[model samples]
Target: MKSEETPFEGGPMDGRSLPVLVGPTGNPPKTYRIPVPDDAGGPPTVLVYRRVPRAHSKRLGLPKGWKYEFDPEGKRGGGPRWPWSKPDPAPDATPGGKPDDTHG
Candidate 1:
């Protein structure tokens, strides 16, 4: 018996489950799913989507930072606030970058 081989065989009819690798398939690292909106039964809702900001906009133009937000109400917050702009800078990105030492 080969050590690497499993006793179970996977196929369509066997009720076997398969793992699907998401990357390189046009799937981003993180994805979320939501059902279609219903007006009558569903309450008025707000949706916020956040992502590491991009340098360019696919529709608008050049963009900055890695933080962004989206709401369904057609209103958007100001652009991302750069984490590096603080006087102390985020300690994680500084020398001796361990998390515990960040308070100094």
Candidate 2:
């Protein structure tokens, strides 16, 4: 697991650099989440940051690096709930948790 020193912009994480873990493709996760502890002992608040291009080469227009930008929305379930992105729910499971076999 390789990491890169990534910079963040805007929100509470503005102008901060942190080492982010990159995947096998040598790219960091699209979304970075940070959980801040609640002073009142409630659920922690999560801050979301979205990945974006830091700069592009003027000659060939290739991306130079990546950075994280604060997402104001920062809400849960922010991404598209596309059918392909998620596994389809079982529509015919019996009460015992086995699939109904009459159709099969």
Candidate 3:
């Protein structure tokens, strides 16, 4: 159960890898390759996975998070924000119609 120990108890954990881009709000995006390994580990670890906004995803060629937003495309030119980043009003949306606030 140690953080560093692989969750898989019986054998070497099987895993697959994919590349992704990473960043915190205001920081430039950094590309990374993530492994979506097989369910061999005893339990899932939150070590490697983090969520980004759709705008960021599209800008960086990534996918959305759990919540589905009406506008898959992010704000024009604005990339995704950090999950914890405060929600902001869409540049073009009306006063009441706002963008969904969820990290992809």
TM-score winner among the candidates?
2
Quote the lDDT for 47 in model 1. 38
TM-score, prediction 1 = 0.17
Provide the TM-score for each candidate, comma-separated. 0.17, 0.72, 0.16
**Cα lDDT of model 2 by residue, 1-104, tens digit:** 78999999999999999999999988899899999999999999999999999999999998789999999898555466886686545676567777668876
Residue 16 of model 3 has an lDDT of: 29
Candidate rank order under TM-score? 2, 1, 3
Cα error of candidate 2 at position 53, Å: 0.2
What does the lDDT read for residue 54 in candidate 2?
A: 98
The candidates, ranked best first by lDDT, are 2, 1, 3
Which candidate has the highest lDDT of all?
A: 2
**Candidate 3 clash pair list:** 15-37, 18-34, 19-33, 20-32, 52-104, 56-80, 65-104
Across 35-81, the per-residue lDDT of candidate 3 in tens digits comes to: 34448865443222222343436477654432112222222334678
lDDT of 2: 0.90
What clash count goes with each model?
3, 0, 7
Kindly provide the TM-score of model 3 when superposed on the true structure, using C-alpha atoms: 0.16
- In candidate 1, position 34 carries an lDDT of 24
